[model samples]
Each structure stands twice: as C-alpha cells, then as structure tokens.
Target: MPVVTYTLWRLSLFAVTLVVLVWVGMGSWLAIVLAAVIAWALSYVLLGRQRDAAALHLAQRAKPGRSAPADAEVEDAALDAAERERGAA
Candidate 1:
C-alpha cells in the first residue's frame, strides 16, 4: 500500500507537469522528458517519508523465509527427500 501510494504520487506529479509544459507549447517528447526529470527531483525532495516507507516495506517483503508460496515449500520438501534417498543409496 505504501509503495502504491508513492507510485501514484510520483505519477501524478509527472502528469501535472507534463500537462503544464504541453500547454505552454513545448514539444510532446520534450514535455515528457522534462516532466519525468522534474517529477523525480520533486519526489526525491518531497516524498522522503513515503519513499522510506515504501523501501522498508520492500525490504521486509524480500527477507528470507518470509511467507513464501506453498508450492515453493512443497518443492523444497521434495528436493530434500530426493537428496535423502540418494544419500541412503
């Protein structure tokens, strides 16, 4: 949720800047490029809290043994069993 919120905020900033630049008669490509750069800078400066939250969420999610899928657990068990059988033979 935090990641989603941060993404939405960045995209909104980009869109608004793009619209303004286009309205001022900037070329489409230039407006898009400028808007992206401006949005990145603004988000970096203004969205520190949100960015931190999103980063923390991602870090937690990527930790080992953190709610892995059931199929993955089953596959691990099967691999262990196969290794045990080979060792016994």
Candidate 2:
C-alpha cells in the first residue's frame, strides 16, 4: 500500500477504536490512549506488510539532492571566478 493510504488506514482504525471505546462509557482521555495503544499494536501485527512496503517505498523515493546545501553551487561559482581572476593577473 502507498504511504498515504497506509497512514489513513491506521488513522481510521484508531478513530474507530476510540469511538467504540467512548460509546462504551470510557472517558475521552482513556479512550484516546487505549485506542492509540490498540492501534499501535494491531498495526504492528496486522499491517506489518503494508507498513514495511510504505517504508521501503519512501526510502526508495527519497532523493539526496533534495537536501543538498543550498549555497554549495553559488560558493563553487564564486571560488572558480576568483581562481580565474588570480590566474589571469
């Protein structure tokens, strides 16, 4: 499954669990905490494949260039210009 789809699936599962718990008389905080724990556990057990696939996909799609130093190219250009001026003189 895609990362977005997998994320939505997890969120929906948590919401459903929380709603059920709340309807059954659990307080909001307790329901939210329980739902989070339950969802975390279930996702580990039941959605392992999907989670792994999403992680792999994300890793594969990540680009090192996307995080390169912003000033690297400009600095290289300035250094080259200075070198050329020094050599000419």
Candidate 3:
C-alpha cells in the first residue's frame, strides 16, 4: 500500500478506538492515550507489509534529487490529454 493509504488506515484505527473507549465510559484523556498506544501496537503487529511499503516509499522520496511530480503538473497533463481527445472527437 502507498504511504498515504497506510497513514489514513492508522489514523482511522486510532479514531475508531478512541471513540469506542470514550463511548464505554473511559475518560477522554485516558481514551486518547490508550487509543494511540493500541493503534500503534496493532499496526506494528498486523500491518508489516503496509508499513514496509510506506517506509520504502518515504525513503525513496526523501532521497536527494528524487521526488514525485507535482500535482499541478499531473493535472495539466491530464487536462491536455482530455483536450486532445475532445479535438479528435
């Protein structure tokens, strides 16, 4: 999985855990801390593949002179393609 996806999954897990703990009469502060710890432990134990993929992606992107393209450039290219298709039609 991509880094963004993995991050979102982890965040979602934390949020859900926090909500459940709070719903069950736990103090908000305590719930928050427990949620964080539980989510991290769960992720560490169960999400090795995703974590590894995300770490590798981050490492590659962090390398000097190596980075993903900007979103604007991707959007421009997509728009150009659409325009060409319209012209052809």
Candidate 4:
C-alpha cells in the first residue's frame, strides 16, 4: 500500500483499539492517557520503518546518472538538479 494509505489505516486501527479498550470498563481518564501513550510509542516505532521505506522508494525513483553507488549517484544528481533549478529561478 502507499505510505499515506498505510498511515491512515494504522491511525484508524489505533482509534478503534482505543475505543474498545475504554469500552471494556477502563476508567475514562486512565484509558485515554494510556491509549495516548501507547499510540505515541507505536507511532514512533512504525514511523521509523516508514521513513526508511520512503527513502528507499525515493532512491529507486531517481534516474541513473554517474557511476557510483546507484542511490548515492542518484542523490547527487538530484541535488545538483535542484541547485541548478534554484540558480535559474
């Protein structure tokens, strides 16, 4: 799935989980606080993996340029292109 779709799905699941947890007799304040903490921690873990995946996706999308490590070369080319574009406008 796309990153945005996956992220939305994960957030919806987390919301549902929190609702279920509170419905099962946990006190409102406690449930809310605990759920927030757990969601934050889980997001922290998942977001790292998501960021790495996004970086890899971007590297793959970059066009081939000079001969070096493919990702590094692509990154260099992209940077150069960005710099030239900025200089022009």
State each candidate's clash count.
Answer: 0, 0, 0, 0
Question: For every model shown, what is its TM-score relative to the native structure?
Answer: 0.79, 0.70, 0.67, 0.41
TM-score comparison, 1 vs 2, better candidate: 1
Note the Cα lDDT for every prediction shown: 0.93, 0.87, 0.89, 0.73
Rank order by TM-score, top first?
A: 1, 2, 3, 4
Q: Considering TM-score, which of the candidate structures 2 and 3 is the better prediction for this target?
A: 2
Model 1: per-residue Cα lDDT over 1-89, one tens digit each: 99999999999999998999999999999999999999999999999999999999999998767787667788999999999999999
Which regions of candidate 1 fall more than 4 Å away from where they truly are? 69-78, 81-89
Q: Candidate 3 has what TM-score?
A: 0.67
Q: Report the Cα lDDT for candidate 1.
A: 0.93
How far in Å is the alpha carbon of 41 misplaced in model 1?
0.7
Per-residue lDDT tens digits for candidate 3, residues 1-89, read 49988999899889988999999999979999999999999888878998999999888887654566777788899999999999999
For TM-score, the strongest prediction is 1
lDDT of 1 at 83: 100
lDDT for position 14 in model 2: 97
